[model samples]
Target: MTSQTFGVQDLTLTSVSGSNVDSMTQLHDSYDLAGLTLPNRVVMAPMTRVRSNPEGLATASTATYYAQRASAGLIVSEGVHPHVEGQSNPLTPGLATDEQAASWVQVTDAVHNHGGRIFAQLMHGGRVGHPDNTGGLQPVGPSAVAAPGRGFTPKGPQDFPTPRALSGDEVVEHAASYGEAAARGIGAGFDGVELHGANGYLIAQFLSSNANLRTDSYGGSIENRVRFAVEATAGAVEKVGGHRVGIRLSPDSGIWGVEETESRELYLALLEQLSPLGLAYVHLEATTDDDTLLALRKAWDGTLIMNPARPGGPTPAGPEDARRWLDNGADLISFGRAFIANPDLVERLRDGLPLAEADPATFYAGGDRGYIDYPTYRA
Candidate 1:
């Protein structure tokens, strides 16, 4: 393995060794995503790889990694912070600066060269971050609450800090940041942008009743709680055009001390507001039941990208899972960890080839060992 240090993080590259099976024609079926036609319906889900430099810029390795997995119907890049304070972990990429956006050009160009449509997932960590990770800037959220778990900082894992509550004006400003980042991503040659409103991030923090104890117009009622998400999505849509914007939401996920007691009402109201936006798609990390998923599908008339992961399972979605979600009205299916270890995931799944298990140890260790060294299937 070869290693290099970028800023305060060390990245390593190592090789990894997979077999052949029959083609899954259904999974290989093409689908129309906005104006872009995806060659297949297997999407590479946005995952946090932490492979960027200290200044929060994507490196050449980052470009190569995504380019290797360009076989997917669509690729959603890792969670990219829209601002410095929005970064939740060390070494994660960002779109907050011109240099950052320029750095991402390599990634977009690489993926595009391989005939892959890529979307930049704009993520704001909010209360999920620590000052240690954000260069001494305190994380900001809908309320002054700290996430339950520790955050991975440059020094080491540290306890989550109580974030400052953003004022109504500041909240609007933060929402606008998504739009700015979306434009930056587009400028960098990305096909589109996906707003990260899921997984207990800033938008999720505002949506969750437990995390958001605010009494302002951005909280309290379901409508109020969903205001930030709606505004953020709207802003992104306005900036990049609705056809180039998407939003990802994880309802009923209790991660990071976020408890959405009113998940149903909150998401429904949010969807109602977003349905008319004519956005590209809505990616759902489905933590709810079949009924709720069905309801969500009906509520949002546009395209739905569903990622069905078990409560605590380590495995990513397989062909069976894809079939199930597609039958249930999902326009596309996304695989996370599976893509981490299987660059040829689309071919592997399509041909029923055995998947290479991802090395859990190297997931966020900042390296190419488990990032890009996974080989394609051979007979």
Candidate 2:
């Protein structure tokens, strides 16, 4: 047994039984996610397909796409905005309306009937969007700062505008939106909901030092900055219960201009604040170092779903990456792009078969070409 340094807090990392075939077998084994029983430990991490219709409704292909990947222990659906104002880009789905929620029923039913548990990841883009992409509604964040990049729209890429700063009251409302979305997701037949508290979206903007320049209780110090994330998590737990709710966090990910000055201390404080809610799991992206990840894994009391690659990064998590993470204290491993090209990812890994590669061209806002046309190896 190797003694690992967690943090200055003296938390220790307990080594896994070992890696290699043992890890692979263990990963494919069934486990309990809160009250939900997952058939394997491979999680299909949320990847925005951007194929939603103008009304933010998911189509039949969406159902087929996810249903094909039903072999995953958990399938976290693409980022769905809680409201139109929170929409990050064009053609992304939403969980805000009754119609949108009803639209997801088909998707949830598809995955469930195939023996897969699915979770809706509620994401709000914050300052990282353009008005052209948001139906003329300006994106809102904790502050009025503009993100450093362009956003996708029907007219092609457009400049990201300085988002309208949410008033103090509006800030509170936005925080509650996650819980509201979680309720809609539950109503839509989802097994659970994972709050998108990562990747420089609404939650990340509030957690960012440079992005969130407000002096209110929602920003400034580490304690203050982590407040919105805590409230969002609490809201989800309030609506759907803690066992059905989880959150994805990127400790030091600087994506979309969100930089955590003290990634270690910030996330530890966040974990401490969220521990009381008793969420089903905390998904951590490999956007930071192993030491910080180990500390976060130690600090989080519930399940930890580890993504072996950085959020929105180029790399895809493979079996070897998953094995190493399992050795490093990750309960479940998430795969992003790997799951995109390989619907039968679990079967491939379990049988030691080849993993398929996804085409980057048809990744977003397209027909069924690259979306659902990926064939199983046996096919």
Candidate 3:
């Protein structure tokens, strides 16, 4: 692997990949999502890097880091915890503080100044969190069940913490937190907001029966389980408007011990419920097979953004993968690892250029050496 961050070598690789694309320029052209025009279809998917201030606020480093990738058509920021109990790790950032909200202002300004748009991804860790990470605050979830695997604590990996089962009033409290966080996101000057209802988080936990044993209005049947996500979306929409909000779902994914009995039935029902909301878009994980993804596309009437889960590689092959989604009814494609290696990925894809190899070691490390140092195509 080349130690050099960015240069002609990276561009050369992008050219190699670009040649496989059907139409480089057309692929690089702009598109619209929820009436917001994106300069191109290259979206930077939300990535977690345990970089935050001691108080869980977004620091200057976080702002600088995201600003470096402002060339993306749309940059979805890392999961920002809506509530204090939502904190999954000590390193995760939060939007609960005025300081954190204030710090994100620079990030928005940087991206906007560079002609890029951004959205904040709101996440509630639920059962995924540990009391050690949240100042001894009990992790809240739909039930008291613990996840199947170990979680990272400040010292090291520890058993999954037993979460406090939320009551009717607590559920409402969490929803209110989501609404307040969405408002904070807009206050931070984000172009829009994305609700992280995927990856076995709080919302997804509620949607899965294995995690939620509640018999109340918030649990049991698919409709009852999916109510939390629907309400969470409603909360965000109420704060930022439906047009400025998006929701991500991993219907078939069993991530972090979230077990859905009837995956298809539950997700389709959720989609049907969300259909009337007129959301900005529905982002599904790339793990969904072609058949399943196609079904979702048909069910959802709004913009569909698919994350192509590339095996053995962090980033998907841009043009070809994007074309696949486009052909399958996806209006946009989100790239996670690709944006890490190529800051000017859109330009490279447009020019039929090679992509720069990403350094996995620096993916979560706090430094400009890997974050902002990625080079763009010089020619």
Candidate 4:
């Protein structure tokens, strides 16, 4: 009998091999999550690749790309629009129509075949999108506000238009759409779904004081402002089991003019509401200090996945950072750009191998040049 090999390159000796294992204490440990026993605590965070077809369908290349990085304990796919109005950019994938859902079966099958658990991240861009990018349809948000700055469209960069405020009835309908999308994701072979309620997107827009200025039941007061996110999460949980659902939130992140004047209170209140839902996990983007993060961990009584890096930070999360967070309280640590270049990230971290640097130039320009061309470590 022979052991099967599973990386882009054959295993080889690296400078950090053998000696670095002791430093990765909790990072190398296994944990049971929502009935699934993950091999490790490393998670591949969701990232927009903009590599799908114009029809918002996943291509063969998408399956190949995800299969290459199946070594991660779990893989959260790039932000995928649950509906046409939720699409934020050109060439991003969606789970709206049957064709789009069917296209993802290949990608999911590829990951499962490689012993990987994957979750589809459902993102609604809201005002962050432009008509030029969403097939001439006007973007809609909780309020009629335009996000600050320009957005990249198919033609080029364009100013974001002021989105139409959804009526109370329409808000309910939009929230229900997330449930439909979650059903579609499960049907398409995804293990679960993660609602993108962060990074100044639709859910975050509703939670922001600057972006949401409405006086309706979905805005104004803290409870009202958090109503939309709560409803969206409930809708997703209703369709898919709570154990197969998760939500991502970036508290206090002021991107796209989404200023949370009362972030600490806002998130704590939101978590109090969501803690009883029995959701799979809560993924938080670490934009604040460690004390703040630990405070958040103490508040939420569920599995927490923390991305331990500020947006546009100089350094990416390494094994040391992972161990620190895991030791502190985080059940899982997600890596974004590190997984982009190192498809075999799990093995590299386990054996203490040097990681290849990713090219920033081709991060989102499409094609496979920077998508899947990076080689694994070798002798």
Candidate 5:
């Protein structure tokens, strides 16, 4: 049966505000995203595991971690640094060097072997990085402003430093670097790459009116502020074709002190440029209001993945939450913290099994205890 025939069902969404779409999506259905046919509408949301070694390479444990959760329709790997300066947190993985890219072969191979698809999330920390975490190398951003928060370090959380402002030429190069990372990710056996343009990182920093205090062509105006993010995505599209690229965005999420006064206008302009690229999909977090999000959904023509739960909300995104979003025009639903302890999350959700609770202590302590020891459901 087609999506139009949700006939005689109690589950129905009459319409969403600010958008013309009067349709609803089902969770267990398949979707044609760009060219790849996803088996289900459940995407494994990317979370920062920080399980890599000091050399910025993924471990065999990392391979096992993702392989166990391969039942999801699509897996978006944790934030991966495209370059040294972009490394957001300590002990995170990278796709910067040839060696680093090679290190992920096991991860991609394992996921593919388990009949799963995976994408690498290219993230740049910008002013959020501490020199202590990046081997004394100062971070860089669109402006010299420092984010108003602490950054993770070996000693403990330290104050974020003022990043060196990038010149116009460097900004262009940094934007193009997404293409280089996309090539490496593809070569490393990933199905595609997702540009991490949200959660107050480099792209978000550039988009923020405060973080990106530049008078140049890359700042101030809405179009100018979105230039860096657009260039970054376009670069990836140029290198790996539009079908192989996706981007994650959290409009109006003031994480790490990045703020947008006119989020709706800014994102609409950003999406206008991105739509012509024919991206595989656009993953959006529910940072902004329903009206703004629905408006964005209408503006974007391709597949839309929605993380319905608010960031850092007390409760995780649950089945009910998924149903609500699916009914409201989201093509796919993502679960972040819910996927942590429940490796077989897809099966559990499909079969109506209970989920396991995750240990917060061992989340980033860098051990196998909470990372891979979570067992699947039992009768």
Candidate 6:
């Protein structure tokens, strides 16, 4: 089933009018992904809290943290490194171990108990890590180059180390690792899995010309560069079902010195190939939602999910912004910071109520004081 003929069966899309703020109340109010029905369209984007056990497993706090956000129609869990060497921070958890995989079971159970669907986001922060963080294992990427900035190591902030460019065989190994992680995510009872290909991580490193200097099948031309990501995603879908998968892409992102002269070609070809996978959706993060991406949305032929840029830095837009995307043909809008501060974001948006401000200080700290302590509107 190519994206060209990708069927949209009874997809409940809400109507939106410029003058009517309530028009968005029905957008994707009733949509099914792989047999699971969503109550609404708002999705909680994956965020990194860097809070995990020393052995790199999710703790009880993690489960409680996610359960609080179960009100969202869908939840994309925090980034989980698929491989040990792929670990970005010691505090960041992984699904590589039996315990690590088992720990996430509580999280999925919590979400499902509250009628929420959650997807574990599999991320591999390639050159964006250091040996100090990975038990002396060398960070790997498409090229043996260092990113242009520092990363938070266990000791403290240090320069981003030059990564070992992955051999063709290693690329396959990592892709397989993604598949294994997806399988583990399924075992943990997640509704689905998402490939974290954005934010200059492993996949982004391969996509960017500045980071990927390889001249082989995984580099040079846009097609070759995107091949790694497509293949990785293919492996993930193969392990877990296609309907149980999603991919996040950050085209033209310069984070960590990632740059692409022909991002349009790279992503277009990537999406064109991925369209047939029957994946849940394509998650895109662009500075300003551009028409080129919107054109890709048409080409994608599946549900298109967008992460809008927040004016005040990482804040999720209000109902008006979500409505704007719906009016422009977006299938779903993902909220980051707003979801963090407001657990009942859907009700707040629906009733036109004021939102609570997120305290930036405790965004990543480990404690229930800020994690699940945000109060809902009493009025």
Off by over 4 Å in 3: 2-26, 310-317
Give lDDT tens digits, candidate 3, residues 13-125: 23322353333334456888777888877789888777777687777677767777777778999998988989887778888767778878888898888778999998889
Q: Which pairs clash in model 1?
A: 22-351, 24-350
Q: How good is model 5 by TM-score? A: 0.94
Question: Residue-wise lDDT of candidate 6 within 220-279, one digit each (tens)?
Answer: 988888888889899999998899999998777677788876777778889988988999
Output the lDDT of residue 370, model 1: 78
Of the two candidates 2 and 3, the one with more favorable lDDT, higher being better, is 2
lDDT of 5 by residue, 1-379 (tens): 0011122123344444333223445576788877788888889998898889998999999999999999888999999998888887999999888999999999999999998899999998988898988899899999999999788988899999999999999998888888899999999999999999999999999999999999999999999999999999999999999999999999999999999978999999999999899899899999999999989998988889999988788777877677777767788999998788889888777766667767677778897988998888763
Tens digits of lDDT, candidate 4, 107-204: 99999998998999999998999888778999999888899999879888899999999899988988887889999999999999999999999999
Question: RMSD, model 3, all Cα superposed?
Answer: 4.2
Top-lDDT candidate index: 5
lDDT score, residue 42, model 4?
88
- Model 3 clash pairs are 13-354, 13-355, 14-353, 14-354, 14-355, 15-353, 15-354
Steric overlap count per candidate: 2, 0, 7, 0, 0, 1
Cα displacement (Å) at residue 17, model 2: 10
Judging by TM-score, tell me the better candidate of 2 and 6: 2
Clashing pairs in 5: none
- Can you write out model 1's per-residue Cα lDDT over 25-121, one digit (the tens) per residue? 2567899898899999999999898889999999989999999999899999999999878998888999998899999999999999998989999
Query: How high is the CA lDDT of each candidate model?
Result: 0.86, 0.86, 0.80, 0.86, 0.87, 0.80
Model 5 regions lying over 4 Å from their true place: 1-24
Give the true-structure RMSD of model 1. Answer: 8.0
Cα-based lDDT at residue 197, candidate 4: 94
TM-score versus the correct structure, for each prediction: 0.92, 0.94, 0.91, 0.93, 0.94, 0.91
